[model samples]
Target: MLVYVVATALAVLFTYISVVYDKTLKDSLQKSRYVYLKPRIDVWQKLTLYVLRVASVLPLVLVAGFRYKVGTDWGNYLRSFRSVTHGKDGHYGEKGYRFIQKFVAFFTSNYIWLFLLCAIIFAGFYFVGIYKMSINPPLSVALIVATSIYFSFLNGMRQGLAQAILFFSLRYVFKRDWKRFLIFVLLASSFHKSSLVFLIVYILYGFKIDIKRIIFYIVIFGMVGLAGGQLVKYVVMKTKYAHYYMSAFADGGFEWLWFFISTAILVVMCCYYENGQKSELKGQFNVLLWMQMISVIFCLISATVPESNRIVWMFNIGQILSLPILISLEKDKRWRLVLLVLILGFYMLATYIAIRGGSHRVLPYRMSFGGE
Candidate 1:
């Protein structure tokens, strides 16, 4: 117990320092030491870049590995895979039996290595996307993205991996690069079909985000809540996601209201920066608007709603990282400090809840594959 608390506190502090370093460290070095991804960057620059990343990432790696090593969910995931393949049902009823049996056979050959490969792939997508599009470079974003407690501990590997691609796909979305964005979305959906929600999200900028629009979304949310169960039932009976409605709708996951609070915060933030807002915040405002809608609608519809929280979190991850970064880029020190507190506070609460969890298996990262 003490171990988890101390480790989480240290992780949070270390992340704060790493982000500060990323902002200021450039002034101390020549241009050669700063650029890492550019092919034409000098050898000295590349080496320095690697050293910097190593310095920041090494500790995060150690802590993250600890979480994974203590991971209980991975074992269950393997069990679900085993059952689904052997003609037995898995934990999630009948949601993904066919899909799991198809590709997850790779797990039998070398599951651990495959997991590692996925972790690395997610890391690459996270760092490049956040850094390239964001004002902060990749190192800082890499440090932040690595500490995804849901990704590392709750065993949200599939969603984690999908969100990584979503992180990258946002660039294409911004560019209206529909082809590339669709390609990325297809890849993400292969990891976890729920990421198909982002399909609606990808083009959300088409609608402006404002108070009137926010009210409109709230109205839509209420309407969906009214009609949720039947709509879900219809879709489930008709489509592959039929199984999705089974556990997800049955779960009655009202706990996912954290997304509602986050949505409220985002609306406030958008209003705060309305005239003075940065472009990224405006973009993220639209993004949050989409996420909030997706989360609320899904929760309303699911019969049980077992995975609704996880899906809400799928949306939360984008809001948490992108909104604060945009706030940081606002050049208002006061807003920066406040945003820092909220980000730190939110993750700390998440870590503590997960650690103290009574039914700890319920963590978002631990995807159960009860393939009915």
Candidate 2:
């Protein structure tokens, strides 16, 4: 536990330093300097930025990937990997995940490699998205840690992979590049079929809808939630993924209430910014707003549908970017600082509960490098 906390603190510190370097680079670019010295300084800053980015993600990848009996699914994944026959037709997981398992099994037959590869894929995409889309990268990174979403990824490997893929694809969604967006979403779906649900985002990207109308949609979704379990059962029964839902998993119930509260806060923040600040990123705010609404609906639906938290996360992951982006919109430095402190405080408390809550089963961290 101490190691985990220390590693996370180090990553957050390094990431903050990287953001400071970014500001320095911009400020330096406006200064007049000797041509030779300027280029050298620019190159050095860029290299430092790259290294810091790697440092920011390294702890998370190592901690998650090198785990032994940490995540709830660790044993299940290990057993599946060992039992899988190479070069055989099987529907063990989504095609992308199955291919990864097969590739790992064919060479070293080590489950460690499987975890490592998935960790790399997830961290690589997730960090890249945070760096590109977030206006406040440090805050975003901290939020991700505090939310325990990174730990969640260790357990839900397939869905994590898909979510990371979708994270990258969001840029195309914002750009309205339908072809690229569709391609990436399809790729993500190959990792987890539920990722296909993200395709609806393309239509919602730039569509103008008032908040009242959005509320109406939420009401309709709440009604659907009343029968969500039966609805899910009916659909799963006709799909190959039925086995996963065959046994009734425990209802998430109020487990997802925090997401709803966070989403509401984000919505309010974005609306405040949109109405007052008048930034150019208003379109991006709208996109995030719609995504938050969708996430809220999914959260409600998951209340009745067993194991639907997996689906809820697909939309909820938007918070990683949404919250940081909203915070960045504040022009007053003092207010920004206050918001950051409050959000961080809340996140710290939430993370403490999540880790101790045991639903994620990530406590008592173990490593595979040494004897298990």
What TM-score against the true fold does each predicted structure earn?
Answer: 0.70, 0.89
lDDT of 2 by residue, 1-372 (tens): 676788788778888888888778776765635443453355667898899889988888888888889877777777677776444543457888888888887787667788888988998988888878887777777777776677778777888889899988988887889999999999999988889999988888768757667778877986787566687778877886676565546434655546656565656764665543377777777777777787677667665666667766787677787777677777799988887777777777777877788856888888886222
- Winning model by lDDT: 2
The lDDT for every candidate, in the order shown, is 0.54, 0.76
Off by over 4 Å in 1: 1-41, 54-72, 80-110, 136-154, 237-249, 276-285, 292-306, 329-332, 358-372
Across 1-372, the per-residue lDDT of candidate 1 in tens digits comes to 444344434544544454565555465455545665332445776566555544543433443333432454566655665665566655532243235443555455334433445445565676557555665443234334333433342355566677778778887876778999999988888777877877876767687655556567666865765566566567666876566555434555455435445555555555554543445456655665566556555544333433556566566555534554545655678977776666556655654564457333423322221332
Best by TM-score: 2
Per-prediction backbone clash count: 23, 0
Clashing pairs in 2: none
RMSD of each: 6.4, 2.8
